[model samples]
Target: MLFARRADWKATKPDNLHEPVTSTKGVKVHYTGTRFEPFLEVHALCAMRVKEIQREHMEGKGDSEIDYNLLVCRHGVVFEGRGWREQNAANGNRELNRAHHAVCAPTGSGGYTDVPEKMVRGIQDAIAYLRRHGAGWEIAGHRDGYATQCPGDLLYGHVLNGSLDPGVLWDGGNHIVRGGETLGRISVRYNVPSDYIILANPDDLDASGKVKDGMKLWIPARGVPLKGADPTPGDDATEFQPFPGAKWFHEEPSSPIITAMGERLVAEGCSEYAKGPGPQWSEADRASYAKWQRKLGYAGAKADGWPGETSWEQLRVPYVGQKPGDFEEFPGDAWFHDQPKSRIITAMGKRLVEEGCGHYSKGPGPQWTEADRHSYAVWQRKLGFNGSKADGWPGEYSWDRLQVPEDDD
Candidate 1:
């Protein structure tokens, strides 16, 4: 592999260097996030770019040195930055920097979607070198913990799919499952059969034939797709996933369901994820869910980030199961709180009155009123909801049950 020392690139010696990072969870893959020039393929230009990056990090970003431990060029040449000796600043914040070593590639968005094979090889080389030093086994993209799209989509996909891993050979070795992966998903990942994996590690799975995060399973060599057919995500990637039960959310380990939920939260403009809404549950998920709850008129402890049945139903994540019927999407609790004059509200009031839940003394006009809450509360009680769940707020489940006429308003 072609390699260059800092001296080779004439990089200015940085005045500040942090204590050496002797250990880390793994390496984070990054991209230049700038337009790439064809001329950069030349080693000299690559060197110049490396210098430019150092200058930018040191002068522009006020970093003590180049943020990456190493950088890979288009031609698969690895250039030393901090060179695995010092901590990197490119992983977003202090905690993230402490956890993962950073390696950047000279690639970016817009006309730079496809990554070169050689570039990938160089990144793998950097990762391998880091591992031999003190890095752990996980390989992740910068976006895994950071909010920005540094590595971009194509490369980030490679990181998640293990294309960036130095090893792809499945030798029936012991495999450790991480958050967001199951036996079925792992089997598809390694081209191994589900039954074969189950047969090999009989003690690792639970009664339901599922693997938990951090569980170790021995995978037999690649076998015919489960039952001599191709494998698909099945319910794993559905339009509307059934709530995996409250326990799954409250206590289950990292899961793709959580990731799906995070994505939904983001879609609903209620994201609080700083790093990832990845498969693992974190404060970000709770904070984001709290936003969703508050949007739905929940307050105080009611707006807590935990996913309740009503809130989860309202989020309507596209995961494993679908909600039946074509009721109008919940316009959000905030909308009703705004007391907007609209035909939608009028129609909803009519439905509440028809259901014998209306407490209105006057017309259930376009304008919202306290009577709407009283009526909705009655409906919620009729549905067996009490306490906070019975609050007059129009939850998605109750709203759907009411089947208020669809209105342009």
Candidate 2:
């Protein structure tokens, strides 16, 4: 999805502003943490909220724009907040403001909500854009750097688990085969199961497993590749490598190892072919790798599939730096609890109730009251469940029904 640039903000520039110090310390993620009523004008509401945050910051409370350097809406639209070179007051620490880049996900009082997949991809794209333009480091979510639940729970989990795999084709559609493509070749190229390719392209195959060239075939965007035995003699020997060093590519954040593998593959043929980060990998890189792999007689010459270790070793690729999944630090699981609760708790409670859980209650504190019971009932009903009258008693069926697994153990 393409993002429309914020021309209005681009037209205005601050005077004599000191550029922020760009360091690779960490990335910070945040939530707008404001209540957004449905059916209201979204853009206007967001603009108003941004203004309010600016007012609070300028009143000697923080640096002047909304606390984040960028804001992502539920609809997946990205808006500019603070300039990259300017300090932001959104995070509580001034020192962090100088070193960290901030990005905000739109959320209400709820800690975090469903972030549109497109928005997540857009965030990755923005980070890549920033890095290419010399923002000085890779991207990270707000929870990564500080103790807070800013980007929402689901998204935070995606980043933590390395599952989101930003920068790949995410439209989740089917691809049609062009001329000069073979099923076995295409299947290996995309890491898609051969059966999946066959099933998707039923019209092209005969009983003998023959597929004619130029036949239209349906290929699912996200599918697992078929694993094969090691390439035999005369098989292409080119391997997959990744970009060198800790440099971040805007696309494919999840599989850094593959990127490194691709880099090594190129280096094997021509040392000059392996260079440091210049821009996001282009079709040229894919074409070059394909040429090398084909010349080496490797079966996996196409650049459309996820890379595995076998692909790397067959092409004589070396693992570079830390393996893709390695990380030295991570914010503790209870990070979200530290964010000011003015909006998060209320929103999360309401969401829980809306999802068919009833009588939602906050933690293990002793402040239970009739008001809490009433709120719980309302939340339950909103979630489309039958809620009983307000009853402030622990172990009540409604209370039990409403409990969510706590992140803190």
Candidate 3:
């Protein structure tokens, strides 16, 4: 493989940097987010782009050094972006970044999609390099980490389908994505988070958060256990708080997640239960969740309504509304407090329609009208969360019943 070390690129000194990453789940696929010219010569243009990313991280973003451990140029050449001895800034948040080494795509990885074959190969080379070292087999995209769209779509599509995987990741397993699937949805299938799916199959999603249908992805056999409820998040809590994922299913019971799942199932016209879609993954909830699963071409065990990450995501259940985790840290703030008009409100409106909760003769939109609030209030009351929780604000408990992606809002 054609490899260019950092020395080959003549990189500049960085202002600051943290300790070298000690261990990690694996590599993360990233794009420059800027459109660079593709080149046949490989070294020159790709090297310049690598240096440019370093400058952006250090000079523009005011970081210690280049955030990535390595980069792949258009001609399938692996150029060292941060070589080693630096923690990546692009992975997830602080603690999360420690679990990953960053790999960036050269010129063709961003903006205008359709990552070149050569660039894809270069990314593979970078992963292979990381693998040769101590990097784990997991490979996730930027969107899988935080809420940004850095890698772009085309390349992310390749990741979903497996053009970026090759022999790098362990055969943890493969998941063939069905229709209406996202990384979040796919993760739900395996009872894991979208981030786990990304790390297990880094090539599957682009930074913009677009996923490909019928894409066969890698599922990590093991990793971080899903987080349960947090008592105090930002204050004196010693435990770092991560947003709930399929962990909602495996870990301790999250009433909000359970409620959100039930609400979303009802909206999707999958509820068979005469009564409760209550919290705590019940038999009724499974039956309803399974109904929606069958609609996705899942059958038998696949459609058994246990709420896998893929189906949960496909269900578009908003897991944030009534969960213990506060929305103050995420988007859709006013959403949990007031039924204000916003993207999250719009999503809630749509979820309400799916649950047959729409009062409007027309439909829901971005603006939250009295009708929307009332409709949500009605759903809340039906779910047994009456009183202030059912004031139509769709608190953590109510939002969990809806199961909508926090960022999806």
Best by TM-score: 1
lDDT at 13 for candidate 2? 36
Instruction: Sort by lDDT, best first.
Output: 1, 3, 2
lDDT of 1: 0.72
lDDT per residue as tens, model 1, 1-409: 3467788677788886587889999999999887664323433345656776787688768888899999988766678899887889899998999899999997877545578987886787677678877989999888886798879888888897887776543445778889768778987787554655664665676436687788878776431112221111111121244555566667745765676677667656687877546777888898999999999999999998888888888886643222333446667767888888888888888888888888999958888888888988898888667765677887655665667756634
Root mean square deviation (Cα) for candidate 2: 27.9
Identify the leading candidate in terms of lDDT: 1
Give the candidate order by descending TM-score.
Answer: 1, 3, 2
In the order shown, what is each candidate's alpha-carbon RMSD? 21.7, 27.9, 23.2
- Colliding residue pairs in candidate 1: 145-275, 239-318, 240-321, 241-319, 241-320, 241-321, 242-321
Residue 328 accuracy (lDDT) in model 2: 20
Give candidate 2 misplaced runs (Cα > 4 Å).
1-16, 22-26, 40-52, 59-62, 135-139, 163-409
Task: Write one digit per residue (lDDT tens) for candidate 2, span 183-285.
Answer: 7777666544355455455567643456665566665443111122111111011112232233343254544344443444443442223443122355544
What's the lDDT for all of these models? 0.72, 0.45, 0.61
TM-score of each: 0.41, 0.37, 0.39
